[model samples]
Target: MLDAVVVGAGISGIYQLYRLRQAGLSVQLCEAGDGVGGTWFWNRYPGARFDSESYTYGYFFSRELLDEWSWSEEFAGQPETERYLNHVVDRFDLRRDIRLGARVSAAVYDDAAAAWTVTVENGERLRARFLVTAVGPLSEPYVPAIPGLAGFAGVWHHTARWPREPVDLRGKRVAVIGTGSSGVQVIPHIAAEAAELVVFQRTANWCTPINNRPITPERMREIRRTARTIHRTCQETPGGFVHRPLSVSALEVGEEERRERFQRLYDAPGLTMVLANYRDITTDRAANAAVTDFLRGKIRERVKDPEVAERLIPTDHTFGMKRPPLEDGFYEVFAQEHVSLVSLAEEPILRFTPAGIQTAARHYEIDVAVLATGFDAVTGAIRRIDIRGRDGVRLDRHWEAGPRTHLGLQSAGFPNLFFVGGPQSTTGNIPRATEIQVDWVMDCLRHMADHGHRYVETTPAAEEAWLAHVESTVRGTVLEDATSWAFGSNVPGKPRVYQLYAGGIPQYRARCAEAVEAGYTGFVFG
Candidate 1:
């Protein structure tokens, strides 16, 4: 039996495998796809790019990797991102231990042996002393159960599961559903090529300009010089980003000054508008409203039609309550005559017609339909696998009310099973957050080995306390009440619970360190 089996070849899994192997453990990485790069590998949809700065989003574990690879764009697109991950794999010679196309069907823990037997879809079973699931939060795609979807004559594809091969949208009338991050990114690109484009927005999201630009040689040199600073800043910040919110509240400034501050943030690149704005934009209702109104006004200015502009503006949630999309020419696309917006709130999608989509108002005849419907998120990927722990208790059933874990790492009764970048973990700048988690997991495993521990599982009391802490951290924040994917609201029948640690990187890191310092206080080892 191998020391550990990591389920995913994504950012988290790749790093976890490398760390485990470096520690002299026999580890294997299993990827569902035919290749590496997990999310980047699958999300090959039009206009797929980083909302985070390319440099900040990448791996910072190796100084050599940082110095050698320079991002072409401020926010690198899918192809480049995929290539970067492939480069990492090849550079580190990680391909030998990775099993491609090995989708994990089930993972069952043997109580007597204190080991896990992971079964792949191909009927191969790999037994390992420990199991680490790095199956990303957004890995499992969520497609709405619209009637007559299978009978639709035209081609349809979910944005998350976009084909690796080229999908020709040129000259064809297309309908894009859902106005989440993926929808916001793909719509503009589709409008540029498709003969006619119809965007069906369920709840219009708060979006800001990405302002992506090429990284010049001079900028690359500067980035390399300050790589250490950049990484340090990322670790120090709340969201694990180089961007940090100002200390002063938005209410402290005058109306004109607030508008000017919002404008500067609006024109800025990536998530600066949200992450680097005033401190209370996400917490205080009045402060959030000030920023929200500023954003709404910007949307109105971009779209020429007043009615269309209002339709695109969100009414339900504040600016940062739901995760906003960083877009390029997204609002401007609605100004184009051939492109149209269908407010699903006004006329909800009834069903799928043979030609295209049929809403409550009319039938949209289109050659293609793209479901930018988004993912089940957080727990979906882990829950997809039939994971059984002590006494054959199912992981899905255990988490039916929502995910329960200590530090989003280990659940009670699931000894030797850990999660990286999954539910109840850090929320922002994912790679950085996952890096922190993977390092902590590595440290935990090392502690286990040093202590001659064969099995490690979190105590029920610790899991309960952690869950309570998570709820308390987000209790009064805008995110706590928002009905978004952050709380599994997008998926029907999924329990609506706060699924991520919103207390920032430093706080989460300190808590993890405390657990370790307390001799892994919450965990029981055998």
Candidate 2:
């Protein structure tokens, strides 16, 4: 039996495999896709790019890798990110251990042996002492329950499952449903090409400019020169990525100063500036209102039609609560003569016709349709696997109410089964967070080895405490009030729990450190 069987060969899985090997453990990673780069491999949608800056978006374990690999842009697009992952795999010689196109159907723990039997699609079974699920939180694409979707004569695709070939949108009438991050990113690109573009918005989202640009050789030299300082800054910041954190509350600033700051942030590249600049923007409703109003004004200025601008402006949730999209000309897309906006909130989608979608108002004919709807998130990917633990307890049945894990790493019944980037874990600067998680999991595994422990699992009490702590972290905050995929609000019938840990990276890192210092507190080893 292998020491561990890791599900999903994404960034998390890749790092986990490396770390496991370093610890002298026999490990293998199974990826469903024909290639590596899990999310980047699948999501080839137009305008798809990383929200995090390119420099910090990669693995931090190897300084050699850091020095060798260079990013082309400030924000790497899907292709570039995928290429980077491929490079990492090639550099590490990880392909030999990874079984691509091997989709794990189920994982069941055998109490007697203290090992997991992982069954793949072709009825092949692999035994492992431990099961590490690096299956991403946002891996599962959520298709909305639209009636008569299959009957559509025209071609349609979800942004997550876009075709490998370039979609010919040139002069074709297109309709994009849902205006989340993917929608926000994609709408601008297609708007330029489509003969007529119709965007259906359920809830208008807050958008910031993605001032993406090429990274110069000089920039890379500067980064390499100050790599230590940059790494330190990344760790110190609340969110994982290095940014200018808010030292002062928004309420403290004067109207003119605040407006100017907001405008400057608006002009700046990336999604975090406005939200991360002011501490009170996410806390105080009035402070959030000020930022929202400024953004709304900017939208009004960008879009020519006042009505269309107003329709695009979001007032439902406070800023930073929902997924903040970074895009250039996303708001301005409504101003294009060929593009039209249809607010689903104003008039709900009635049904889908063969030609196109039909709303309460009218039927809009389109040659192609794009579903930019997001994922079930956090628990979806993990739950999809038929994971039966001790006493035949299924992970899905256990987490039926919502996902509950001790430190978002290990569940109670699932001994020797671990999760990275799972529910209740911090997703701030995903790669940074993933590295931390992988390190933590590796440490725990090494501890098990040193102690002669065959089985390891978190106590039920610990899981409860962690779940409660996670809920408490978001309680009374603007994040708690917002209904987005981050909180499992996008999928119908999914429990509306705060899946991600709201606690900043620094605090989370410290907490994990403290737990390790206390001999891996709350975990039972046998």
Index of the highest-lDDT prediction = 1
On residues 1-526, what C-alpha lDDT tens digit does candidate 1 reach at each position?
A: 9999999998889999889888889989999999899899999998999998999989988999998998999999999999999999999989999999999999999999999999999999999999999998889999999999999999999999999888999999999998899999999999989999999989999999899999999999999999999999999999888898999999999999999999999989989988999999989989988998889888899889999999999888888987789898999998888999999989999999898888889989999999999999999999989999999999998898999999999999899999999999857988888988899988888888888999999988999999999999888888877999889899999888999889888888888889899988899989
The worst-scoring run of ten residues by lDDT in candidate 2 lies at 268-277
Task: Kindly report which residue pairs in candidate 2 clash with one another.
Answer: none
Q: Model 2: how far is 69 from its true place, Å?
A: 1.3
Off by over 4 Å in 2: none
Residue 68 displacement (Å), model 2: 1.6
**Cα lDDT of model 2 by residue, 343-374, tens digit:** 98888898788998989898899889999998
- In model 1, the Cα lDDT at residue 19 comes to 93
Residue 64 CA error for candidate 2 (Å)?
A: 1.9
> In model 2, how many backbone clashes occur?
0
C-alpha positional error of residue 159 in candidate 2 after TM-score superposition, expressed in Å: 0.4
Q: lDDT values of the candidates?
A: 0.92, 0.87
Q: Which TM-score value belongs to model 2?
A: 0.98
Q: CA RMSD for every model?
A: 0.8, 1.2
For candidate 2, give the lDDT of residue 298.
79
